[model samples]
Structures are given as structure tokens and as C-alpha cells.
Target: MTGFVYSESYLNHITGTGHPESPDRLKAIADHVRNSEYWNSLKSIKPNVISTNIIQLIHSGSYINSVSEACENGFPFLDFGDTAICRESYSVAKLAVGGVVQAVDEIFNGNLDNAFCAVRPPGHHAEAESAMGFCLFNNVAIAAKYAQKKYNIEKVLILDWDVHHGNGTQHIFDSDPTVFYLSLHQYPFYPGTGSKNETGTGDGLGATKNFPLSAGSGDKEYMDIFENILPEIVIQYSPSLIILSAGFDAHYRDPIANMNVSEESFSRMTKIVVKLSREVCEGKLISVLEGGYDLNALVSSVEHHLKALQGN
Candidate 1:
């Protein structure tokens, strides 16, 4: 069975009015999933609030404190302006990380084959010391650390297809061979990272891989890499668990990004990952939401993704 990790409290992050990373993103997905055919078949799970101590696995203590203080003092944004927050944002971000960690626990315990964490304020952008790109805390990064520490997992493969390169996740594990970070994103894009030459350093020298695609690239381009390039790298890495930073902003309908990918491509890509996880890691995989701006596109793309996750 596929586990769906979420919490109503995730809606309480409150990025603000007119923000692309608004609560409506999750609401739209939640609404559609509940009304869709997969609701009953998918296991529903509410995330518990993880302690700040767990968050320190990925974020520095001072940075975590600053986020709390900023929210408590009613700062409008965590960074210059993109990452908006409210009093509940710090706690909500914790819940988002917790959701991913809980999914890890569930998969390890064999309660579910895999999971998709429908959470926000979307991570993969937040760094160890600062929040960026509408992300307050790095959810997937924390989950990787949590899994390593608790489950004694030796290797993790983080596949980020977020349109924007997951600079935060990449940098966090830039030198750690235990976590391999692979990304396929628009090059020369926002956050200004993820170049072909920016592979990992030191012990992680070859663990980081990036496939930078051009604008207007659609299904054929993405599929070429997924079918030809991705499988080889993933099979060789042979991680203990797979984590996907599943972002749908590459959809043709999304406003914030420029890519021509459709929902079918998302499903196809998910299926590839699912098959890879099953082969390489006994189907131990977890997908965490990152960015999908257009509400309709988000809903449709997520539906396709979840269905693929269910092996439908």
C-alpha cells in the first residue's frame, strides 16, 4: 500500500496572499485526492510534531531559533521576500519534516511499501542556516539524516525534479557520500545553482549528479534522461532508500517556471522511480512535495504521481 502523509496543520503555514507557495497548493491536492478513486486505497496519515532537536539534524540550532523568533515576532518573510511566514509557520515546518520522517518509519516498519508527503512550506530550498525560495526548513534533508541515524541506513538517493535545482539539499550533502543528490532542473534558473560542474566534493566527489535541461523542454527530453541516464546512475548507487523531491512547477500550466512538461510525464517519471526503488531498495521510497504553483496543474500532476506511486 502507498502511505499518504499530511496534516491539516500544514495549511496553517500561511505564506500570505498572492504568494505562489500558498496554502491552496496543498488544499487543492488534498481536495482532489479525497474525491478521487485512490482515496480509499491509499493509507491516510497525519504527521506528528517533531521536536526542534530532530530539526537540528539538518539545520543549525541558531538558524532554527531565528526562524522561531522571526515567526513569533511577525516577520513577513524569512529571506528577502519570497519565504513568507506567520506565528504557526515554524511549527508547521516541523510538522512537514515530521511527516517525511514518519513516512520513513512506516516504510522501514513495513506498514506501507512507500509514501508521498503532501507538505509545505515546501522544502529543498531552505539551507542549514537560512530559508530561501519559500522554504523554511529542509524536510527531505532532515528525513535523510533521521533515517541514517535511527534506521542505520547507509546510503540514500535523493532525486530532485523540481524545475529549480535543490541547492539546499545539494549543499547539505555536498560532501557526504552516504546521501547521493541527483537533480534534473532548468539550468541558469533561479537560485543560480546546479551547474554540470558542481558535483560533490571530498568523500562525495561523484555522488552528486545533475542533468540541466533547457526551457520549453517537454516529455521527450525528460523521458530520454529518465529512461536512459537515470536508471544507470540509480542502479549503480543502489541506495538503501529513495527520496524524491517531487515538484510539478515544470508543468506547462505553472506560472513560476518555464518548462513544457505535462502530467503524463510526471506519472511516467514517477513510474521509473518506483520501478527503480523496487529493484534497488526493496520498494523503500518516499516522495516529498516541493513546488507546483498552478492549482489545477498541481492537482492533476499530483493525482498522476500518487497513482503511479500506488503502482496503478
Candidate 2:
């Protein structure tokens, strides 16, 4: 069974009106899953209380404090543009990270082969010291570091399929050879990072890979990249765990970005990842929600993702 980690607090991280990253995003997924046929197959779990020190593993102390202070003092946005935070955002963001960490623990403890975290205020765009692109804390990055620190996981592979490149995640692990960050996002897009030439640096050379697809690229292009490039890399790296930054914004129905991927395509990608995980890492895998703005597309896409995660 695939564990599903979520919490009601996620809806409280308010972004106000007219923001794409609103509370409705999570609600849509929640409603759809509860009413779906695969709902019973999922083992739902609530997020645990995450400690501040654990969060410090991925973000600096000063930066962490700054976020807390901003939330306490009621700031509308963070230092960078587009990262909106309310008074409850800091606490709720920690819960989001907690969800991912809990999923990692469940996977490593033999409780589940894989899990998916349905979280909001997406984290892939949040850097170590700053928040941007509607993220306050880097959830998946913190979970990767936590798996390393607590479970002695030597290598973690982060596969980000968000429409916008996970610039923040790439920045955090750019110099670390232990973590391999691969992102396939829209090129010349928002935040303007994730160029093909921007591989890793220092000891982490070639650890970072980016495949910036065109705006209208669809299933054929995405599947070709995954089938051709990802398998070889996963087999060679042999990571201790695989983490997916699953984003449904690439769906053709999504208004945020211009990709033509379908829900069925997400299933194929999940199956490929599952097969690779089985071959390389004892079937250990976990995924966290990132960017998926269109309500209908996000709901249907997550359902398909969960079906694949459940090995159906």
C-alpha cells in the first residue's frame, strides 16, 4: 500500500484572493481522493510535529528565524517576490515538511514501499535562505537531508517534474555529490533558472540534470526523455531513496504553464519510476506535491499518480 500524508493545517496557509496557490488546490485533491475508488487502498497518515533543529538541516538558522519573525509580525510576502506568507504559514509549512519526513520514515521502516505527500505552499521553489514562487520552506530538500541525517541514507535522487524548474532545490544541493537533483521544467519560464548548461559544481559535477522542454511539449517528448535518460542515471547512481517533486501544472488544462501532458502520462512516469526504484533501491520511493494550479487537472492527475503509486 502507498501511504498518503496530509493535514488540515495545510489549508490554513492562506495566500489571499487571486493567488494561484490558494487553499482550494489542496481541497480539490482531498475531495477527489476521498471519493475515488483508490481511496481505500491508500494508508492515510497525518503529519507529525517537526522539530526546529530538523528544519535547520536544510535551511540556515538565521533564515529560519527570519521566516518565523515575518510570520509573527504578519508580513505579506517574503524577501523574494511572489512568496506570500500569513501568520499561520510558518507553522503550516513545518507541517508540510513533517509530512514528507513522515513518508520517508514509513518507507524506510518497511511500513510501505512508497508514499505521497499532498501538501500545499509548494517547497521546490523555496531556497535554503529565502522563499520564492509561493514557497516558504523547502519540504523535499529538508526530507532528503533528514533521510541522510537520521536514517543514514547516503544518496537521494530528487526528480522534479514541475512545470516551473525547482531552482531552489537545485541551489540547495548544487555542491553536494550525495544528492542528485534532476528537473524537467518549462524553459525560459518563471524564476528563469534550470538551464541545460547549469550542471552541478565542485564535487557534485554532473549530479544536477535539467531538461527544459518547450511550452507545448506533450507525452511523447516527456516519455522519450524519461525512458531514454532517467533509467540509465538511476541504475548508475543507485540512490538509497527516490523522491519525486510531482507537479501537475504541466497538464494541458492548467492555466499556469503551457505543457500538454495528460493524466495518463503521469501514470506512465510513475510506473517507470517505480520500476527503476525496484531495480535500484528496494522499491523505496516517496513523492511530494508541488505545482498544479488547475483544480480539475490537479485532482485527476493526483488520482492517477496514486493509482500508479499503489502499483495498480
lDDT measured at residue 182 in model 2 versus the true structure, 0 to 100: 97
- The models' CA-based lDDT, in order, is 0.93, 0.92
Instruction: State which candidate has the highest lDDT.
Output: 1
Per-residue lDDT for 1-312 in model 2, tens only? 799888888999999898999999999898889888878889998998988998899899999999999999999888654788899999999899889989988988899999999997799988988888888899999989999988997999999999999999999999999999999999989979999998999999999999999889989999998899899999999999999999999999999899999999999999999999999999999999999999999988998899998887
lDDT of 2: 0.92
> What are the candidates' C-alpha RMSDs?
0.7, 0.9
Evaluated against the true structure, the overall lDDT of model 1 is 0.93
Clashing pairs in 1: none
Instruction: Summarize candidate 1's per-residue lDDT along 196-296 as a digit string, tens digits.
Output: 99899999999999988888888999999999999999999999999999999999999988899999999999999999999999999999999999999
Stretches > 4 Å off in candidate 1: none
For each candidate, what TM-score against the reference?
A: 0.99, 0.98
Q: Which stretches of candidate 2 lie over 4 Å from their true place?
A: none
lDDT of 1 at 167: 96
Q: How many pairs in model 2 have backbone atoms within 3 A of each other, for residues 3 or more apart or on separate chains, i.e. clashes?
A: 0
